[model samples]
Target: MDEFAALTERNRQLSKAMMQSVFELACDLSGLGPFPEQAAKARGTAPVNARLMQIQQLIEQLRADLQGLRGPYLMQQLQGLGVDQHSRALQLHIGSGPYVLDGWINLDVFPAQLSTNVLWGLPFVDGQCRYVFLSHLLEHLFYPTDAMALLQDIHRILEPGGVVRIVVPDIAQCIAAYQDGDTGFFRDRVEHWGAGDGQATRLEHFLAYAGAGPDPAWLFEAHKFGYDQETLIRALQRAGFKTILPSTYMASTHSALRVDEHSQIASAKHGDRHYSLFIEAIKE
Candidate 1:
């Protein structure tokens, strides 16, 4: 393993050990919480149990916070104006890989208006953006952790009634096609993007670019997770978004958020559906 990922894994191991120790402490304290007289504890005079519960809650929060950490390898790439509290443009195109918009800020790892890693967290203050769009970016981040962190951070930065549009590969459709032995779907998916060998089987084409090998750089660009319409909408709801809906290619209500990958648009132009799941959520 590389130095950075090795350090991260070691840190997580250490943290899990520490958390287990802390949870044991909490459990031990619970037995003594009502000691020296259960009456006083019942009357709220002895607040040991209450205090223990608070500590446990804090521990859970800290565990979640651990996922927010970014190794220096990734953190050093965070460049440009950190937090644009004064940016008048209300639209943000995060992870904009050549889908740069006219008025919105194009943010990516290479070169854009804001070249930084979103995994660390968004640099903008709360309610700074009216519309946020990220195409094929969520799947790149680790699911239920980095992905959720970014979604929650996006929700925090979006203004009330603001919108967040997410576009990702439709794993649901891929699985359906595989189960039905629909070679045409898999063939079209691979050919539409010209990203993989068209002759590959459904399973192979589905996971085509999931890291060329164990190399850290390749893994960094690979799809770490997949999501369907239901799971994605549920995640958005958990992020505190009020209204969530499944959308279509280039059919977003907001003109600024309609920008999508050309492959998705072209595939949809010829067929009723493509291998992209488009979903939108409104922060309220």
Candidate 2:
């Protein structure tokens, strides 16, 4: 396992042990006796309950402390910006991968000055943002529930007429190409799959690229779920977006909400223009 995986495992084990210890302490203090029918009949139960509440409060405070520790530097940067600056910002780019725009606050999980964990929830106030953009990000989340929650959170942070533009790999197109026996599709994208020569079959290359490989990078970038137009629209609708529509690259109903030209140029060069699906949803 990589260092990140090992560290995450260790943290999980520690959290489990700590929770168990806290539960045991609470049980011991509460006693093995059955509950009394009346509060007046109970002897010293009030003290036990009070102690348990105190312990629970301490645990909650510890949780807050841990959250602070997870992203102290990011938090400092955000705080320095102040609430007014964040609220006044018109656009946000979630998981922005090198496609920086002039007016948008670009955020990512990796090494960026504005790095943020979106699952922890956005820092902006409700109905504060005018636009949010995400490109090739939803599939990286390991669960549909998590993706839905993120969408709902995005919806919460957007203005009533705000829009969220999303771009993701088109699974329908991939499957269609595969079924049509398009060997070139697999062979051409082999570099994205992994470091292997011409030895591996096209099927193997396709599988590796689709995230069934042994590479740690594949594990990190693997698509948990692929989406076509319909499924993606359903997800957005479920998140309370009233208006959802399919969009083409670099084009949108709203001029201000168009996809970045750099992203369009990159997509065209990468030969995934037809392999990607773009969708925009309005918060109305």
Off by over 4 Å in 2: 1-66, 70-72, 80-86, 191-218, 264-273
RMSD of 1: 10.9
Report, for all candidates in order, the number of backbone clashes: 0, 0
* Top of the candidates by lDDT: 1
lDDT by residue (1-284, candidate 2, tens digit) is 99997897787667666756766665764675545324524663555566668978998899898687766666676765454534653688888777877667788875444766777777677888889988888877755687999999999989888999998777666676678877666554544434466677646644543435333323444666778898899999899998998998777888776765556422532355455788999998
What does candidate 2 score on TM? 0.68
Q: Which candidate should be chosen as best, given TM-score against the real structure?
A: 2
* Model 2 residue pairs with clashes: none
